[model samples]
Target: MATTPLRVYGGVTGSDRQAERRALFIESGLELLGSPDGEAALTVRGVCRQAGLANRYFYESFTDRDELATAVYDHVVNEIATTALDAVAVVQEPERKVRTGLARIVRLIADDPRRGRLLFSPFLSGTPLVHRRTESTRLFTQLLGTQARQVYGMQGSTRLELLSGFLVGGLAQTLTTWLDGELDATEPEVVEWCAEIFLATSEFPQQPGRTSIHVPDGSEP
Candidate 1:
């Protein structure tokens, strides 16, 4: 069967226009969700106004505000993760890789306080956003664990997973406080501390005592 050519209006195809609208809505979502107003700017009307689109266009891409917010959140998370992964992939030394990856995260958020607020701010902790954050944390936990194992030439173990969770969760909370202006430290300083934590946590304990930290894969959590 032959495919029909796309219908164009004012020199743009119907699909092109639709994708443009979706991108606009996502951008508006980022701006609003990260603004000082936080999730308060998540109303359909507010988002529509910010995007300069009719209310109908919002439904074209997202079912509601939460869907739009999820898209916005996913966009930020994917970009950060991809950038960090790429940064680490290029470096040969593990410490350099860790520092380089972490520096990208710190710089990205520091350069845009809006992203920092959108990500780790207490004000943005609505139930849906919280759920999404939890899911994203699990993803990062897996990524961190995999990278640590590869870098250190270690096999998967329960202890490595535990340390990864602790480091990822701890760093997120630290960034939250830092973004909230409670840390009283510079962005580089925060990156340094976090890199140290990552490096130290990546170190494996060789000895097994009566109450050792390392549990075999089948052990209880």
Candidate 2:
């Protein structure tokens, strides 16, 4: 097949320029949405101004603010998830793996308070962010349950589902309060506490006749 070479404008390929603009929009979206008044600052005009791009460019990558918001949220989750997995992969001991991953996630949020607000803000209204958060929780629970089986040699069961949901939902709630300054703990304190609970929950013994129990769709990895 004869393939056409990509056309470039001003020395930038079309797709490259689009991706660059999309990246700008997402970064600006993060800035606005991660702010204390993120919800109000998320309009198309606001995002365009924040990104220093034209309004048309905003529409170029995102049909609307809600779409852009989800894009930003997905970017944030993928970044943290990738780093956490990488951190865990490097440690040999299970405790060390848990601690290392927790430290990375906690430190990431600590370093960028905006990330924390975007990911775990309790004040979020009935927005796409809330809906997406629920979906992300489900996805995370699936991954966690799968990992528990691999790391702790546990079978898929209601016990695993319960613990996974508890850990994911509990951590999100705690981080939300902590980010709001309602929790008086330091970053290390929070990470250590979570790591302890994570280990404890993962290592809990299974009850008889419950090891084969399973959640519905989205429960399996």
For each candidate, the alpha-carbon lDDT, in order, equals: 0.87, 0.86
Q: Ten residues in a row with the worst lDDT in model 1?
A: 203-212
Give the alpha carbon lDDT tens digit for every residue of 49-128 in model 2.
99898898888688888999899999998888888888888788878888888899888888888888888876555488
Error of 2 at 210 (Å): 11
TM-score list, all predictions: 0.87, 0.87
In model 1, residue pairs whose N, Cα or C atoms come closer than 3 Å (at least 3 residues apart or on different chains), thus clashing, are: none
Q: For candidate 1, what is the TM-score? A: 0.87
lDDT of 1 by residue, 167-212 (tens): 8899889988888888999888998988988887666583335675
Off by over 4 Å in 2: 1-6, 208-221
RMSD to true structure for each model, in Å: 6.4, 8.2
